[model samples]
Target: MIRGVRGATTINQNTEKEIIQRTEELLLKMIDANAIVAEDVAQVLISVTNDITACFPAKALRNLDGWDYVPVMCTKEIAVPDSLPSCIRVMMTVNTEVAQKDVNHIYLYAAQSLRPDLSKS
Candidate 1:
């Protein structure tokens, strides 16, 4: 079976260093929580708020030890009025035996408010 693991995180700045670091941190937590393997990931779709323009968040995934071949795409999040800023969201589709209800979604920093029901913190 295939399932989607969702996660989000926020950054204080739009620098490449900040974006890459936070994105990598979120993805690592998601992988650990879900027990996901690089080979099982079908694709990763990352969306960042319009305020973030330093670089693609997908760059973080590619830097992972075994994720160089994983498919990753990055885009801009929709500009909703009064929405969260400097946010990066990720939807990772993977081949897993885990049931949908068992999947874990991670939200970090200020993004936790975006999904209080799903956020572990």
Candidate 2:
């Protein structure tokens, strides 16, 4: 079976270091929560808010030791009026035996307010 794990996090600044750090943190939490391995990941789709332009979040995943071959992409989030800023969101598709309801969705930092019900805070 295939399932999608969703996660979101916020960075204090738009620097490449900040983007990579927060994105790596969120991806690690998602992997831990779902027991996901690099081989099982189908693709990772990352989107950052308009305010974030320093770098692509996918850079973090590629830098992971075993994730060199994992397919990942990064894009800009829709600029919805009055929406959260400096936010990075990810949807990771993976092949897994876990039931959809059992999958964990993570939201951290200021992004926690974006999905209070699913926030890991």
Largest lDDT belongs to which candidate?
1
Candidate 1 per-residue lDDT, tens place, 1-121, comes to 9999999999999899999999999999999999999999999999999999999899999888999889899998889999999999999999999989999999999999999999887
C-alpha lDDT of all candidate models, in order: 0.95, 0.93
| TM-score result, candidate 1 | 0.98
lDDT of 2 by residue, 63-82 (tens): 78899999899988889999
Q: lDDT score, residue 6, model 1?
A: 98
TM-score: which candidate is best?
Answer: 1
- Cα error, residue 94 of model 2, in Å, equals 0.7
CA RMSD of each candidate after superposition: 0.6, 0.8
